[model samples]
Target chain A: RKLESGDAAEARDNFAGFKLIKVLNENTRNKCIFVHGSFEGSDDDAVVLMEKTPFDKQSISAMLTSTTDLKQVMQNDIYGVYTSSPPPDLNGINTTIIYPATDRHIMKYSAQQIYLINETAEEYQEITLPFIESQPFSLQWVYNILDKKAESDRIIFEDEDTDTGFILLPDMKWDEKLTENLYIIGICHKRGIRSLRDLGREHLPLLNNIAKKGKEAICTKYGVKENQLRVYLHYQPSYYHLHVHFTHVNFDAPGMNIGKAHLLLDVMENIEMQSDYYPKKTFTFTAKEKDPLYLKYKAAGKM
Target chain B: RKLESGDAAEARDNFAGFKLIKVLNENTRNKCIFVHGSFEGSDDDAVVLMEKTPFDKQSISAMLTSTTDLKQVMQNDIYGVYTSSPPPDLNGINTTIIYPATDRHIMKYSAQQIYLINETAEEYQEITLPFIESQPFSLQWVYNILDKKAESDRIIFEDEDTDTGFILLPDMKWDEKLTENLYIIGICHKRGIRSLRDLGREHLPLLNNIAKKGKEAICTKYGVKENQLRVYLHYQPSYYHLHVHFTHVNFDAPGMNIGKAHLLLDVMENIEMQSDYYPKKTFTFTAKEKDPLYLKYKAAGKM
Candidate 1:
């Protein structure tokens, strides 16, 4: 919202009137620049954010395959820093940029942490289950989608089978570019099942149907093959509703990292072999310091 | 080795004669800048690489808490880009640099893929197991270490309990700096077990011992608590020799991502519950395009 408002203002009047005050924070890990600033005639303080968006596959491929005029800014043997600008479309705000920089360049530029949480089945029941039940979150939107009261046009595929069906839709974060970073989600039709911990052998049919149909839909509509997809479920999911994520395997997606992602195939097999595998297995996930689950773990001395 | 050779040369000559020719590749994913060039007086072809290093915790904390002069290079409402350099030590080769640059800035400036391989138990037996068996790789180096004929001085901790014994050492990639990125490896003294696929309930004692003692050694020596440590093993490891990685949770270490890393605790639990769990279970791992495993998968039409 802040960015949109900023965009509107900048569109009307080029940032000639904007003035900088001081640096608020620099999140180098996420490549976000935030600063305290204000308009020339305004007394109200404003916060400005400049974030680096992820590169799509097409742009990178073009660069690697095509010839570009490269200007080396500095050189130290095999180590050199250079600045280059692609045609306007490929370049963002910073026309002159230096990259393929080291981890040190990014981290030293300021900072960054995510903690891995190992939650036993008993702990899940005692701590996480209770926390989810007690926490107030609105799932009305999910219900609306399931009931075809909202986002019906956005649905990529849907099987209305009451016992074994789900609605597949593009995740809000997806730009629908059909690139390697493509992402979509399949939200199950059946309610009451809340996250991976709630699944069992009885839910295998539903899981299998979703996995099969979801891949087919993507392949048919987006031209992405099944092999190029990463089908997974998140343990300690952000929302209570059971949903499956279908992403391009090439996408370095956040939250899809280890300690969080459980492959759908593995889950299906685990359940197929053992009825209560999901409920009984110890799932290791990540919890940030600000997470309530982290606080709960701290309270239980589990950390 | 190239980096070390450059360091040695620069230590004496101060990179004064270095000259740039052109950029070869810009790997934004790894933050490495590679180029083609030669010395000031020579026509000999040369290659140079500039990489941004990972930041240490102390340096970032000091920056966030300290006062720094503000200089704005450009501003556009909620977006602005500025360049500043930290004191010499905190800064690397680049004296002046921009912070919180965006993904667009990084990716558009260059380009990155890892593929997720879903190997069923049958596929593992038919393909991966045989491929690994046929690959000619030398474990003589590992043998030399276990025999106390190599890297003896670098051993951080060792337990000679025949069945559960292991030698712990700082990972070569670790700089021996006691920070959140601290990394160490525990290589089991017992031979024959090559990877996670070979583990069963019989090896629980060895795993548990490594998990426990490895934590104690780090806590005692580095003052890092067990909670701060992430102990895991790499699936489809760079090497077949079984070893456990001990890393501080704060470090965004490579190969620890979803498809590659398996928590030591989970592996132990899975094996404890079902002796042949790993042997029968499907595993999801990553493989690059050039990997032999990928080629094998291709031959089998698995991909």
Candidate 2:
């Protein structure tokens, strides 16, 4: 597909040739490499970001069959061994292993990039609060899933109760297997709840139910114990839907960092202590420089 | 030097032959490799953990000169280049560049190993709190530094105020430079206080002084802006002394994870909201399986 720079032009269905220019920025922590270039027959500049995806059990198991042209780099009693593949194999995959070939190596290589943001409670109110409130968010996807109009087959568990009901399903990022990287999302059935800020004591039952039933269902289906899971919610969630994230403790999933994530238990406790804890409490989070919210803060001279 | 297994025998300061028995566990995230083996002339089982240290400016600058026998692993218009050094160089350094040769690659490759531990507020009181309180902590080294009995030259900043003073020094792990991996610690003048749980409203002035003057001193000396610094304190600190950590925002220093680190700003806010917030709050953190606190939890069947 083609996108003309700064033209607001529609992308064409067919993609053409790509030309290499230069490297832009490579974030190793995030496992993403960005390069700037252009498409053939188009005079506009383009950027290509190649990111390493989280490894699922299937992909890890298939590595032995798919790996090829492995070349030994170096070996030592102290440093272990390093190996890399020089040529692209039949599957067009080039492999590299540092020190050892294990799942730990893969997990560390593909760890998510995290940015820590520190701001006063006042700054959050002046900049982030209004920005999140004014976002033009649509709930069509959430409604569709709740009404079973779309992705009905993906639902793992559901309850029809009005106040405390929620739909549980595997997060798109997950492979739906009983692996350490298991990820699931719980979307509340009740409406008008946008994000953590809107959470209150009245919603305790819903939150508790999601935590309780969600763990039970995962255990029943995947045999994952409750203690093995880390449940939390992102304050400045990507979307406005009220959703809870349930991931294995060992997974090291994205948005689990302190400034970005608030544990479900902590959230409930905060609300129990104060009915409007989330709303009254100050939150600190990171936003990309190019994000409209960040730009608004920049324009307002708050950041 | 060697010692027999299950014996409290002294060893002569002489090294002998070395052998690797087997690879134990490799943690990529932590950039550490563990192997079980034994040294030459020794009949005792030995476990060697090879942990990647943080890179300072000097080591990075020496890479070009130290790198040798560089071999191209793979190159593509889409994936960039991968390279490795087959032979150890004269300096005994082998090089490997996964995708691009950038600092981010090195930084991500050397991130710390973090474990997450979750316990209820009551569990912390019953297990971790008592464990820390009962610990036989000695502050002789801290006292020596404060009295200029030792390490006076290493002190970057110091204040003599009894209630709101501290001696700031470069953490030993740091390279003592103003690089992205810059790490500094502030040891409080007021003694008796231990970890985060011991903090209260009375310690507000001391904490505030550290946060304010620590940033100013670092900025004045290193030219690193206050915005580029992350000031926080470790809850389950390595030592019993009450010390605050000051690190460069770009540096992924160890113990800065959500469960381990508490931002100074957030700490102050929590205290302002409630005089005994830290004491009352349910603290969640990760403890090693071998930690005495973890053993206590296991004994209590709390985990």
lDDT of 1 by residue, B96-208 (tens): 11112222223322323456788877998999989888977557657767888666877899998878999998775455643556789999988878899889988999999
Clashing pairs in 2: B17-B40, B117-B285, B117-B286
Where model 2 places Cα greater than 4 Å from the true spot, the runs are: A1-126, B1-24, B35-68, B74-81, B86-122, B133-153, B176-178
In candidate 1, the second chain superimposes onto the true chain B with a TM-score of 0.73
DockQ of each: 0.15, 0.09
For residues B119-204, could you state the per-residue lDDT of candidate 2 as single tens digits?
66677677776887787644665787788866687789998898999999887555453356678999998887878887899999
lDDT for B26 in candidate 1 is: 53
What's the lDDT for residue B303 in model 2?
A: 62
Off by over 4 Å in 1: A1-115, B1-30, B33-50, B57-72, B76-80, B86-89, B93-114, B144-154
Score chain A of each prediction against the true chain A by TM-score and list the results. Answer: 0.67, 0.65
